[model samples]
Target: MKKNQNFRFEKKNRTKLKIKIFSLQIMEFVTHCENSESSTTSSIIPEMETSSQIVELALSVERADTAALLGADESNIDTLEKKRLEEIRQQQISQAKLMAERRQKKAAMGMEERQNWEQEIERYRIENEEVEERQRRLDIDETMEEFYPKLCEWVGLSNYEVLYNSLEDGTNASDLNKKICGEKNVMFIIITKTGYAFGCFCHKKIPYPKKSYIYSMYDKKYFTFSLRNPSCSEPIYFKQKHKGKSICIWPNDEKNFIFTTKRFIKIKNPNGPHGTRSFFHGKFSLKYKSKDHQKREHTFFTQTTAFDVHRLVVLHWF
Candidate 1:
């Protein structure tokens, strides 16, 4: 009986211990669930805040776009498009009209008539070109008559040929040398813009070896002359006073032709934008006897000390 009583008491105690362990497990599970819930809430709060910020930004952008749309001028865009289209339409119409006119003109003419018309146009073009060429040749002939014969006579060169004209060849030094370097006699004729004309005669080959800023002192045949002078009635000849200096052929931006040096007669910038600048001095001209038995005052060809050139012509003969 005592054993049965003790067994029943132990069984009751075992049931009580099992109930206490189950209660403790339940409490622990509830605490774990609460912690999980709290953690989830904490994690979600920042996400929710970010989403709200994004929503606010989207709303602001939408409002700004809406304001821009409202403020924009639809009429301006429509007007610009219409104007562009109208211009295109007008251009197309004009082109169509031109094409139709051309076709109608073509159709109106017979094949023979078209050939005749083309021939007539060609004749006119040829005649025009011929006329221009004749006029140019006439002008050159006049210049030749005025200076060519006289220059040849003075230089004692009968058999000669035209070498280089600036209007035809070019105003380059290399080109000048190519045309007139080997020749024994060369004459330079320069006409100024102001209608004054002058030139240099080099008996020696051009670009004479004896270059002098003062005087060449060796070349007796080298001389300068004024063809057309406003002050002088006749074409005045300038004998080289400082012992017949050889004419200098200046090159590459120095001077086109240098007749004398130290009170020099020269032309600068032959083909430049400002045209050619010519310098003439009183000492260049030879002194003449006056009627009053007195020394005539020195005079230059251009009247003025300097003038701009109009044309430069170079002729040579072997």
Candidate 2:
């Protein structure tokens, strides 16, 4: 009986000791869980604040773009735009305050960094000035381009050539030929031995007759005109109702009658638009003349006062 009672007491004490140890373990687990959850919550709070800051920054940038272009009076803006501008102005004021704080911080910086910042600002200013100058020149060029065609049309010039150059007698026939080879419809002004002056507008090349006199030939589309002077504004051209493709009436004695050699034939203007090599812009007059004997040889002559204006250009009808 004494052994049985001792065994039961010892078993009861073991059970009580296990229960106390289990209770301690459960309390420690609960404390550990609380600390882990607190740390996770603290980490999530900073991320949420960062996301909200990014959203605010994006919205501010969006407002700035619209506000920059809406620098006019708020009274002129509609209600929606007015509201947007008001918001932008507030954002700008805040930004200005931040800039003021930054300026204070910059003032506390070293002299080297402050000098570098000033140099950066100067570089940006120079770049802006250069951009403005380039844009000004481009605008001037565009204005001039628009003005030229209008000026030409206002003067009643249907794609007229203005020659400022003068050529005289003794100009090489070969040189003249080289210049006129690719040329089209042309105008020629001449002074006769009797001091009479006449000009012709024809196709192909007009003969630069020096010894040979220049007279009219049969051209279906030739236009003859008399000029008091070689001024473009002073032209007196013959109308089509005058003759209308008649044969030369003047006797072909020594007068340089318009005819063709075996090499070249004169005719009316060819069919096409004019060339755009130059818009001759200046004073024009007769310079020199060559002999008609060289007409077949050099396409020019050297003896007559063939009032040579500047080289002919392709005529475009406006």
Candidate 3:
């Protein structure tokens, strides 16, 4: 019984030791397996991370290419816009040049027109002056023809005889009357001392009531006379000296006479009816008396009643 009990105790002790050993081996094996698995997972994680990075780099490259293409398109658009703007500027410059040329042409045309108008006006002015001159000459010729016959009838003589006698005697009478009647122009007249036996000629008309005088005569006297045509007078008488010795008195018309004497004398009635008469007094005298036994005082008388007593006295020494 005692041997059996000791043997049972030993067997129980062995069984416990075996159990502990087996547990320890199982733990070690589990630990070793866990470590191996952990290392392998770490390596696999690194490979996966590297693959993801490669994918990311590829995506970045694609995005970069797309951006470059877009930038190229933008640059092209900017170039096109610049070209268009330059074209517009060129068009504007062309239009400005066209306008400048047009204005210059218009100004040149206006200057040409103004010059033509001035030339036309000058031509018209010269034409008008020539026409006026022609008309004046025609009128003068017509007037001379109409009055020539009337002057001859009024003077009670033929035209040829009046012209011939005037030239021969150096007289201005026929010429003066012709001028007054518009037959000729009368410049001046030669008158005797008595205002009669005078001569005149002219190519123009003379104003009426013309009178003139001679200064010194053969009788030492000044003689003045006047020729006048009154409104109601028929027979004209020639009047003589105011206060002097007179000789060879000749009657010109009513209130007109001439005297030959040795000295100049002033007339009392110097003015005429029309205030158009002229009086001329000469500077020298004529000697007409005999030497010894010559009568120094003599008076000549006219039968005509139309003479003015105060202004027409003729005195001479015989």
> Which candidate has the highest lDDT of all?
1
lDDT of each: 0.61, 0.39, 0.36
Off by over 4 Å in 1: 1-138, 208-217, 252-262, 270-276, 282-299
Candidate structures ordered by TM-score, highest first: 1, 3, 2
Evaluation by lDDT, superior candidate among 1 and 2: 1
- Candidates 1 and 3 compared: the better one by TM-score is 1
Ranked by lDDT from best down, the candidates are 1, 2, 3
Best by TM-score: 1
lDDT of 2 by residue, 1-318 (tens): 889999999877865554454345445656766777554433332232356644654465557656866665454568778789999999999999999989888777756687888999999999998776445423423322433454333334446443211232222333333333334354444332222233445543343434443434444445444433323223344423233332212212322222222111221111113321111111111111222222212112212223222222223223
Q: Which stretches of candidate 3 lie over 4 Å from their true place?
A: 1-66, 76-79, 136-318
lDDT of 2: 0.39
